[model samples]
Target: MNVEPLVPVTEQDIQRYEEDGVVCLRGMFDSDWIERMRAAIERNLANAGTLAIEYAEGKSPGRFLGDMFMWTRDEDFRAFVFDSPAARIAQKIMRSQKVNFFYDHLFVKEPGTLVPTPWHQDQPYWPVQGSQICSVWLALDRVSRESSGMEYVKGSHKWGKWYKPRGFDGKDRYPEAQGETIPDIDQDRAKYGFLNGDMEPGDCLIHQAMTIHGSGGNVTNHTRRRALATRWTGDDATYDTRPGTFQKIREPGLRTGDPMDCEMFPRIAT
Candidate 1:
């Protein structure tokens, strides 16, 4: 399988990511990567990892399932972390000399899933700190607002504010999380300049860790919304043992302020 992106990461894309904190790169991966990841998602659904969370099971209208760190145990996900174009893409967009694989997360929203993912910043929930941390969200199926396309608040990453993390249940994930409360974007959506659009299979959205984003429920009666988010950190990322931060299922074994380039968060590109 080709590991290189089908299309180059242009300067404009990098600029957009820097200025807006997110950029949609169309057709970055080919069908081969898509199919391989799709199969891997199925395997993960059947045998969920230890950290898997079925957020909507028995409580919501449809399913909103999530799991992280699959690359530690799944061969397909391991291959993606080591051999996919995601790392190079992160390196380019972040303009860093090196890139490390942070983790891989799976989000599956079965058709008619009515659980809306609450708006929040990603960094506040994780045990890491850096400006170059990002997630490459790859769509394995057609995506749109109706299918729960993720929407980002344009340029919100530059605001230098960390909103408290929220879970899929629309409740606070950490009661002790210290940060500014998220603005009621839903109440005043027009003022935030939410950026979202339709994406086809193999397309991806690369967004910085601080970007405030969320998605609606999978309202399509029959179209499933499955996505794989491969997170990568660049040269400046480091371990952070902050209070209220969620611990990784498999600890990275790095003390506070250490570079995130150990066995778990292996350096993939330099």
Candidate 2:
């Protein structure tokens, strides 16, 4: 399989990402990568990681499942993390000297799933601190607003604000998390200048760590939404041993304020 991006990350893409805090890159991955990731997803569904959560269990029109750190256990995911073009894309867009592979988060929204993901900033939930942190959300299937495509508040990352992290069930997963609760964007959505739309398989969205984003429920009766978000940290990122945040993998044995280039979060590109 090709390890390079099918479509290169251009200067325009980087400019958009910097301006909007999010950018959609079409055809970033080829069909081969998509098919391999789809197979990996099926494998993950059969054997989920320790961090997997079924938020919509027993109380939904459909199912909502999420898992993280699959690369530590799954070969395909591991290969993708180190050999795929994601790291290169991240480094170019972030304009950093190097890139580190943080972790992979998978989201599966079955048809008719009605559990909306709460609006929040990702950095607050992570044990990291830096503007270079970002996530590459790759679509494994066709995605639309009706199929739970992610929506982001344009340029929210530059708001210099951090929102409290909340679970998909509208509950505080981290009671001790430090941040102001996010505003009710759903009630007054018109003012946010939200960005979201349809995406074909192999398309991906890259967003800054502090970008405020969330997704709606999958109201479709047949189409399922499956996406994998790979987190990456650039030159400025460092370990943050903040209290109240959830760490998916084992401790990296690094002190706070240290560079995140250990074995766990290995530097992938330079």
Name the candidate that leads on lDDT.
Answer: 2
Which runs in model 1 stand beyond 4 Å of their true positions? none
**TM-score on alpha carbons, each prediction:** 0.97, 0.98
* Candidate 1 lDDT tens digits, 1-270: 668889999999999999998999999988999999999999999999888888887767888889999999989999999888888888999999999888888999999998788888899998888899999999999999999999999999999898877666655667877788899899997688878999999999999999999998899999999999999898899989887776477777788999998998899953
lDDT of 2 by residue, 185-254 (tens): 9999878888898999999999999999999899999998999999999989999998888756798888
Worst 10 residues of 2 by lDDT: 164-173
Q: Compute the lDDT of residue 217 as modeled in candidate 1.
A: 87
Q: Give lDDT for model 1.
A: 0.89
